[model samples]
Target: MSSTLLAPVLEREEYIEQAYFFRTLAERLREGVPAQMALLQIRDELLTTTRLPWAVEFLATELKHSGQLGSGMKRLIHYFTPFQAFVMTKAEEEGVRFSLDHALKVLEGEARYRSENPTPAGLFVYEFEVLARCQLGYQNGLDCMEQDSFFDEDWRQFIETVRRSMSEVEFADLIYLYSEQYIQDQQRAGREGPFPRPLFGLKEGRIAKASHGRDPLYLFAALQRQLGYPEVPRLRLPTEQRGVLQMLEHKVRELELRLRLLEGEVRGQVEVIQALGKPETAESSLEWLKRLDNEE
Candidate 1:
């Protein structure tokens, strides 16, 4: 929690533009756009004279030299939060299976939440899920999260607690222990010292209590179902995206062949007797292409 690393809570409009940047960049990257080009392309789409577009321009230049967007973002500590840069670095790590597209989507969702004045409970749950579901190490991940300006000293201490004990402790128990319900119970029991304000809401406490010892994902689902917390983005396989593109290409080729057949008929290249020999059926147009191949 170095003061040097913590950025101010950004303006709501800035977060709105940031969400757009992440979503547009992730979408273009899937279409084979280069990282530097993606940043460059998104500049005009952002609001004029804003710091985000300038950050994007610098990111584009830094990406050219270091071949890592994380390095550039890290340098702009005043604009991009440390946690933001950390995610980008993890996504770019060598020999890692984590996806950059998934990371970007996670960032976009976070920015959208921040634009709406996110609560600490909502932000914490959403970010913790990103680390857990993606298998990102809790130590460094919590270290980065603690540096975010949205959380104060109490949050930093709680995060440290979770960081040290997460391997052995149930996550729901931890949330319940730090919630407002816990503090209210303490007061009812006649504890006299001034108790610290709770970090989690009463509803969060209830969900955590119900989910104790169950799969922690069930807790996350409860939170999202009862509350409007943002859901964690699951990692989508690149091969699945490629398969979809291939399917679309196959359909396009089928249509092209059908068009060529119509053109042949107009040119009198098709024999009327041969055309009448094999009538059209409900089979795929690909089957029609196969029949045409056999005729030749």
Candidate 2:
């Protein structure tokens, strides 16, 4: 656990700049730029007064050596949240499909949300979705999220419950049980135990209840639809890549076509070479080969 987890230390403006820094860094990274270079470039783009410039400058230096932005972020615990660092660290793990670009987008959206009036439920759902959708460790993700300063003791306790019961329980039911609607239902039934304060509103409870027995993703979608919470960005699912043999064959064919066109151009034979790309026949192939041999 981080020392700053008990209290938020950074200003709202800092988070705003962090969002910009991450968004710009991610964009530059997609352009095939190295992580250190991307951080250096984005560091210059940040406002002079914001701590982000200093932070990213440090990140650039750290990335220059370690090549891991998450490590840099973790070192700056006073500025960046643990969840932000967790996302990046998870993205950096080997054999994981999560990329630095996707991790940046996730942090960018969450920072923008935190800069505004973020609710406990909203942040929880957003962070949880980041873990669930990205296939990060659920227990570790929830542990990181639970330490956020925005959540109270009740929220922390509930997150622990989620950590314990996650493998055995439905996420929607978890929310529904802790919500206002559940408290109301208990009251209506004349149950008299001390109830914890509601972490979720009546609407959220109803939505979670309605989402019972369904895919848990729909619960997150419903919350995003109704509450305007930030949605986690997902890595693009990998499409079938071309096989090595297929690529080699395609390259060979391309080289042959280019060679034919070049030979035709040298001999001032434009029409015949231009038609070489069209459907090939044995006769046309022979004619093209003969023409190429003439140039030789």
Candidate 3:
């Protein structure tokens, strides 16, 4: 990763404000506020002393011109992490199932974690969980994680190694091998050669060992449950929201049927015209209704 591409580690207050900004923006979006409007509104809510307000202003300007928040964020690499920009970019992509609200919530959780005294190991787990759970491409996701200034050189090297051979290696084994417990066991067995520095603690190693050969999500769950690591947010619409979406889908299907009927009428299909037009006989009208139902 290029040094210039990586944003410097931000202050605790900056992260605090960022968490607030993301959380507020996501909430507003869920409530149906426009993105540009949300940014303008959030700009005034940020601390005047922090650089976030200026970034918000620029984002608003960019949103007006290009109608995309990710484009603006990508240009502000000096302020936002590459991972943040990448998440927003994915959210805004056409045909991607990921929602912008979910992306903001992800960033909000990350910033909130950063505001606290977060350990490098915990931060790495949280980030990796996001990539895994969201099905974000591991290649770019690991690259972004590696470039984050919050992690040191050792962490970057390990992350790059994971990116290269993630498909070949078992995730649990990877964690266990780099853990202190592994080193202790090796020393007890009288192994002679030097070992790489341990990135995970003994407890993490034990969890990984227990979770071996299982789904990696199990390992992530154990870490969050036992070690107080930050949990990645899952995107699920509420019951009411899902119902509304179903209703809209039904309405769209109805519209499509009507459009098809119109096209058939234009082409002078006798059955389509009879289905759409009033019939002279009640029996004919019943037959038309039956045909329409069958088409539906």
Specify the poorest-scoring 10-residue window by lDDT in model 2.
235-244
Q: Name the top TM-score candidate.
A: 3
Question: Stretches of candidate 2 above 4 Å error?
Answer: 1-9, 236-277, 280-296
lDDT of each: 0.83, 0.80, 0.86
Please give the range of 10 consecutive residues that has the lowest summed lDDT in model 1: 276-285
Higher-lDDT candidate of 2 and 3: 3
Off by over 4 Å in 1: 1-4, 186-196, 236-296
TM-score of each: 0.78, 0.79, 0.81
Error of 1 at 21 (Å): 0.3
Estimate, for each residue in 1-296, the C-alpha lDDT of model 1 and write its tens digit. 44436767988899999999999999898888987778888997899757899999999999888899889988998889878888889999987768888889989988999999698878988999888888777888888888888888788888889988888899999998888877777778988657656788888887888898899989998899998788987766678678888788877876766685786688775884257344353245566666666665
* lDDT tens digits by residue: candidate 2, 1-296: 32435536468888889889888877777667887777788888888888889988888888888978889988887777778888999889999988877888899999899889888888899999888888888977887887777887788889989999988889999999989998998989999868877889899998989999998888888888887767877655324224555567666665676677686678787766555444364335545566656645
Model 1: clashing residue pairs?
A: none
RMSD of 2: 6.9
lDDT of 3 by residue, 248-287 (tens): 8766655665575677667766575665665444335446
Candidates sorted on lDDT, descending: 3, 1, 2
Candidate order (TM-score)? 3, 2, 1
Candidate 3 least-lDDT 10 residues: 278-287
